[model samples]
Target: MNLFLILFGKIFVFLSSFLNLGSGSTWPGHIALSINKNFLKDTLTKRKFKIILVAGTNGKTTTGKLIKEILETNNNKVFHNEAGANLINGVASSIIKNSTFFGNLNFQYAIYEVDENTLPTLLKFFSSDFIICLNLFRDQLDRYGEVNIILDKWRKAFGKLKAKTTLVLNSDDPQIASLGKKSKAKVLYFGVDEMRKTELEHASDSTYCPNCGSKLLYKRVAFSHLGDWMCESCDNKRPIPNLEKLVSYPLPGLYNRYNTNAAVLVSKSLGINQYFITRVLKKFKPAFGRQEKIYINGKTLQIFLSKNPVSFNQSLMTVKGLKGKNILIALNNKIPDGRDVSWIWDVDFERFIDSFKNIFVSGDRTYDMAVRLKYSFKNSHQKLSVFENYKEALKFGLKKINRKEVLYVLPTYSAMLDLRKILTGKSIL
Candidate 1:
C-alpha cells in the first residue's frame, strides 16, 4: 500500500510539473496521508539515512538549505522538501519523490524544514536524529497564534525526544533556550555574542519569562525579544551557547548570522569539520528569494523575502547596510501570506524608510502597503510609488536603478513566489 502511494505521488508530482500546475509539494502527500494515516511512519520507520528536522517561525528554509549545503559539500548526500512545504503533507511528498519504487531513501541525510505547528505532529511519525529549533516569534498569528502557544507545544515535543537525539536551540531566544531545561535529548545551543543595549521592536514576542510570568530584562537585544535576557523573578536566564560566533557568514543581517550559527552548529554536531564548513559557507549562494541575486538587461535585482514584521525589519536593516537605493515591496494577503495584512504596521519602517532613494509598492495589497509607507515617511513622500500590477512595478523599479545599483525587493510569502515566477519565467516551489 505504501509503495502504491509512493508511485501514485510520483505521477501526480510529475503531471503537476509537466503541466505547470504547481510544485506538487503538498497535495500528493495530502492524498497519500488521507488514503493511509500511517503512510509517513510506515515509509520512514526503518530508513537508514539520518533525519534532521529544522523548525521555527522564520529561517526554516534558509537554515535547511545551509545545513544541506554544508553536508553535501562534505560529500554527504542530502535531500530536502521544496521551500514553503514544511507541513506533514509536504514531508510525505518529499519522501515519495526521493524514494525508489519500492520505497527507499538513498541518501545520507534528509533535512526537513518543519512548520512551527507541524513539528510536534511530524515528530509523532518519526524520531529525528537532530532537531534544530531556530527561534520562535509571533508570526501568522491567525494560523499559529502567539509565541507561548508554540512554546507549550514545543516543550511537549522536546519532552518526547530520546537521549540519542541531538536538539540544537537558539540561546538568545528565551522561549527556545528554556526548552532545554527538561529535555532528555542532548541539547546544543547557538547564539550571537554581540551584546549592547538595543531596544525591542514594538511587536516583539516572548519578552516575558517562560518560567515565571514576570517581564524578562535584556542587557542587549539582537532585534526582537532575542538577546541577553534574564528573569529576575525566577532566576531563569539565557543559556550559554555551545556555539556563538562564526569566523564568517554567507549573508548579511543579524538574523542571517543567527541562521548561519544554527546551521554551523548542526554541521559540527554531525562531525563535519570546521574548516570544511567555513569553506562551504564562503561559497554559499542564498536559497531562492532569500537575498538571491538575478541579472537581466544589464540590471541587478536581489530579493529579500520579508513575510512578517520581524523578518521585514531585518530585511530593511540589511538593505540599509548595503546602501540599497531602489526598493520594491510587494504585499499579498493571500492564504499562504496570512490574510491579515495588519502585521505590516508592526514593522519598524520608520527606522529606515527614508534611506532608500525610490520605493515601489505592489501585489494584492498595494495601497495597503503604500499607506503604511506614506505614514512611515517623515519627509516629503515624493519617492514613494504604487502599482496594482506587480510586473509593471518590477519593470519600473528596475528601470530606476543602474547596472551597478541593485533593486532590492522585499515581498511577502506568496508575493515572493509570484515575483520569482515573473523574473525567472518559472515557479520555485
Candidate 2:
C-alpha cells in the first residue's frame, strides 16, 4: 500500500510539472494522507537520516535553505520540503518524491520548515533529531489564533520529546526561550549581539513573560518583541545563547542576522566546522521572495515578502537601510494571506511613509492598504498611487523608476506569489 502511494504521488507530481499546472507540493500528499492517515509515520519509521523540523512565525524558509546548503556544501546529502509547502501534505509529498520506490530516503538530512499550528501534530507522527523554534509572533490570527495558543501547543509537545532530541531556540524571544526550561531534550540557543533599539514596535507580540505572565522588560530591542528581555517579577531572563556572533552575514537586516545565527548554530550542532559553515554562508543567496532580486528589461526589482505586522515593519526597515526610493506595497486577503487585513494598521508605516519618492499600491485589498497609507501620510498623500489592476500597477510603477533606481516590492504572502509570477513568468513551488 505504501509503495503504491509513493508511485501514485510521483506520477501526480510529474504530471503537475509536465503540464505546468502548478508545483505539486501539497495535493499529492493530501490525497496520500486521506487514503492513509499514518502515511508520514509509516513511510519515515525506519529512515536512517536525521530529521530537522523548523517552526516559527517567520524565517523558516530562509533558515531551512541555509541549513540545507551548508550541509550539502560539506558533502552531506540533504533534502527539504518545497518552499511555502510547510503542511503535512507537503511533508508527505516531499517524502514520496525524495524517497525511492520502496520508500527509502537516501539523504543524510531532511529539513522541514513546518507551519506553526502543525508542529504539535507533526511531532506526533515522528520524532525529529533537531527541533528549532525560531520565534513566535501574532500572525494569521484567523488561522492560528494567538501567540500564546501556539506557545501552549509547543510546550505540551516539547514535554513529550525524547532526551535524544535537541531543541535550538531563539533566546531573544521570550516565548521561544521559555520552551527550553522544562523540555527533557537537550536545548541550544541562538540570538543576535548587535546594537539594538530601546523601543518596541506598535505591533510587538509576546512581550509578556512566558513563565509568570509578567510584562517582559527589554534592555535593547532588535525589532518587534525579539531582543534582550527579562521579567522583573520573576527572574526569568533571556538565556545566554550558545551562538550569537558570526564573522560575516550573507544578507542584510537584523532579522536576517537572527536567521543566519540560527542556521549557523544548527550547522555547528550537526558537527560541521565553523570554518566550513562560514565559507558556505558567505556565498549563500536569498531564498525566493526573501529579498530576492529579479532583473527585467534593464530594471531591477527586489521583493520582500511582508505578510504580518512585524514582518512588514522589518521589510520596511531593511528597504530603508538599502536607500530604496521607489516602493510598491501589495495587500491581499486570500485564504493563504489570512481573511482579515486589519493587521496592516498595526505596521509602522508612519516611520517610512516619507522616505520613498513613489509608493504604488495594488492587490485584492489595494484600497484597504491605500487607506492605511492615507492615514499614515496624513496631510501629504501626493507620493501615493493606487491601481485596481495589479499588472497595470506593476507596469506603471516600473516605468516610474529610472535605470539606476531599483523598485522595492513589499507584499503579503499571496500577493508576493502573484507579483513574482507576473515578473519572472514562473512559479516557485
Clash counts per candidate, in order, are: 0, 0
lDDT of 1 at 237: 93
Model 1: per-residue Cα lDDT over 203-289, one tens digit each: 688898988879999989988888999999989999899888977788988899899999999898889988789888889989899
Clashing pairs in 2: none
Candidate 2 residues 28-89, lDDT tens each?
99999999999988977788999999999899999999999999989999988898899999
Cα lDDT over the full model 1: 0.90
Best-fitting candidate, measured by lDDT?
2
For each candidate in turn, the TM-score is 0.97, 0.98
Instruction: State the lDDT at 361 in candidate 1.
Output: 95
Q: What shift in Å separates residue 426 of candidate 1 from its native position after superposition?
A: 1.2
lDDT values, one for every candidate: 0.90, 0.91
